[model samples]
Target: MPSGSVALSARPEIIGGPPPGAATLEARDACAWFGDRLVLEGVDLVMPKGKVTALIGPSGCGKSTFLRLLNRMHELIPGAALDGEILLDGNDIYAVGTRAQQVRMRIGMVFQKPNPFPAMSIRENVLAGLKLARLKCDDKDTLVEQSLLRAGLWKEVRDRLDSPGGALSGGQQQRLCIARSLAVYPNVLLMDEPCSALDPTSTRRVEETIDELRGEVTVVIVTHNMQQAHRVSDLCAFFLAEENQPGFVVEQGDTLEMFSSPRDPRTLDYVEGRFG
Candidate 1:
């Protein structure tokens, strides 16, 4: 562990320098609409399995919308419709008879807010994903420890696994949510502004967890914080949506290179803080 970094060695299975997942993801000419309003269009992206990809842009640019589209989450909205195909390892996730629940099982999600089930204990929260998937683990205690360790929360709450998840501080609750997401062993994790509500220390811990998850799980994140994007991502895509125009990919590439030398003026401006 580096100086100032929290120790996260309790679960050595997820020490990620390179991704170690089984499938890759690609979106070809993807488009989305909320009833009669078009929010995103002509979107294409490829996120390699076991790597971290960051989606950064101004608010309302469809970053979160695109993240939700990956697992058919948008279908939950009435009158919501989409165009194009999102593929997981060359297989269309939207193919007929494919269950949305199954797709979500393989690609888990962590939202911006720390939304631990209020009535559940920390241990229960950590194992929530498995329950949602209707899977049972024989070694429940071990699973909780490993998941919390992977989320960088094991040491603090190891002795109080039965405490209500909502009783935790905002940061701890967020990490608990992360632990819950990891418990299911999803191949890809989708995060929408995961650190938006945390303090600096909490944000750093979450970032470390994301770093460690590399090679163990593919992570796609939407963020307004460019610094966070540059730190945790292997690759990045800049999205833009202007008045009367649907959101589209402005540019994308290696994170370091994209920040240091962007191909488009808008990319350079956004990265340099000239404009969002």
Candidate 2:
């Protein structure tokens, strides 16, 4: 959470998972603040199960903030706090006894930059989460191979599973990061500008991986690139930061409709390149 000058007018109530015409993940009246300043206000959204939802907005509009909040990553920042209900499969993640560690294990994240454990090998990185969870594995090697194959990196690095994770290209490193997330068998994946630092070829490869991941896990991505959002998402949420208020959701709908027939004029403007 960070200080911003946008606020939401209406506060939408919590709608649990699988509501009538609803999606898998829902957030109701979610408000976030860092210290005294509000960043998100009365925001609401639904992400369909096994489908990709893209969050698009200008920088500082709280797109990334909201993405992090979906899985409680916002709390990792100093002085970050929020009010709202985030539901996953009808369970309120903020309820008492709800463990953030368990939430993280089920909802994985990939950052703007590739981050693999430098000291670990490719094989080791894929099994890191399982090890952290203290899962006993009589044949951990099978899990590693399956995870790498699912991540689309096994063929590229099969000969060198023992090689250090740092030795791969930027794209490969990001894939390794994804493989690490997959090792935990998460139900949802949150990506924060995951391909911003990658080149076109690398970006394509990552996009391909995302395409393949659909139907396996719910995906929510925060991205500034409109084309990329259009390319990968089935649903879209638009956010904006306005004067004297915290950032808020402007509109959310089917990806094609949001682009072709946005309800808010501001959303139309942002998507049509009238203003970022």
Candidate 3:
């Protein structure tokens, strides 16, 4: 881990449970910097267990930066530094002696682009997280099936588990990536524009996967699409960064209320498509 890097850990039993449940995530007065420049500041938010929380903003608003901070990915960059605490289920993830790998296993990430190992078979890809985390699976077949079923991709690819993950369609590949994340039984999942690069159908399928993930995995997504945010998230936080200033939350509330009746004018402007 880097000088200022934070890590997390949990009880071993939480690693691969028969019924893995979500965890509440809270950021308190969180701030991030790259070397001498601050990129995000004073971020305070709570994402309840078993629900979706969407971070909405235009590019460069620190929504993605904030998402990375949740799983300790922000600390990977050289000279990166952060202040404040991130708590998972009431325990600070940055507590001394915690391990980065353990934090990642508990809080997985899905990126904008679907990235599956081109040469690895679908089944292998699903099981890859266990290998990386050095976790044991009593029955690999059952784990694979359950993970794929939770990700909503099992029925489509059950007959071809041996096929390369890269051979699946764009939507299927994204769902495969979701299954890969789920295979580790992460309590929280962070998505950075998971549907941006896909076509409408693929995007819709990905959204459905996210919906199905509720009650099993906590989700925090960074999205520029207001409609998509409205369609998927239960909670919404609008972020904004004025010129030469660090990004901060402009407004945040229940998804319906935030969209229909934002207390902040900036939020209304952005959501109404009048301005970013």
What is candidate 3's local distance difference test score? 0.88
Q: Best to worst by TM-score, what's the order?
A: 3, 1, 2
TM-score of each: 0.92, 0.89, 0.93
Q: Which residue window of length 10 is worst by lDDT in model 3?
A: 2-11
| Clash total of candidate 1 | 4
User: For residue 152, what is the lDDT in candidate 1?
Assistant: 88
**lDDT score of residue 24 within candidate 2:** 79
Candidate 2 colliding pairs: 5-245, 6-245, 6-246, 7-245, 7-246
Provide the overall lDDT of each model, using Cα atoms, as 2-decimal numbers.
0.86, 0.81, 0.88
Model 2 vs truth, CA RMSD: 9.8
RMSD values for the candidates in order, in angstroms, are 4.1, 9.8, 6.7
Worst 10 residues of 2 by lDDT: 1-10
Q: Model 2: how far is 80 from its true place, Å? A: 1.1
- On TM-score, the leading prediction is 3
For model 2, residues 56-85, the per-residue Cα lDDT tens digits are: 988888888888888889999999999999
Off by over 4 Å in 2: 1-23
TM-score of 2: 0.89
State the weakest 10-residue window (summed lDDT) of model 1.
Answer: 11-20
Model 2, C-alpha of 21: deviation from truth (Å) = 20
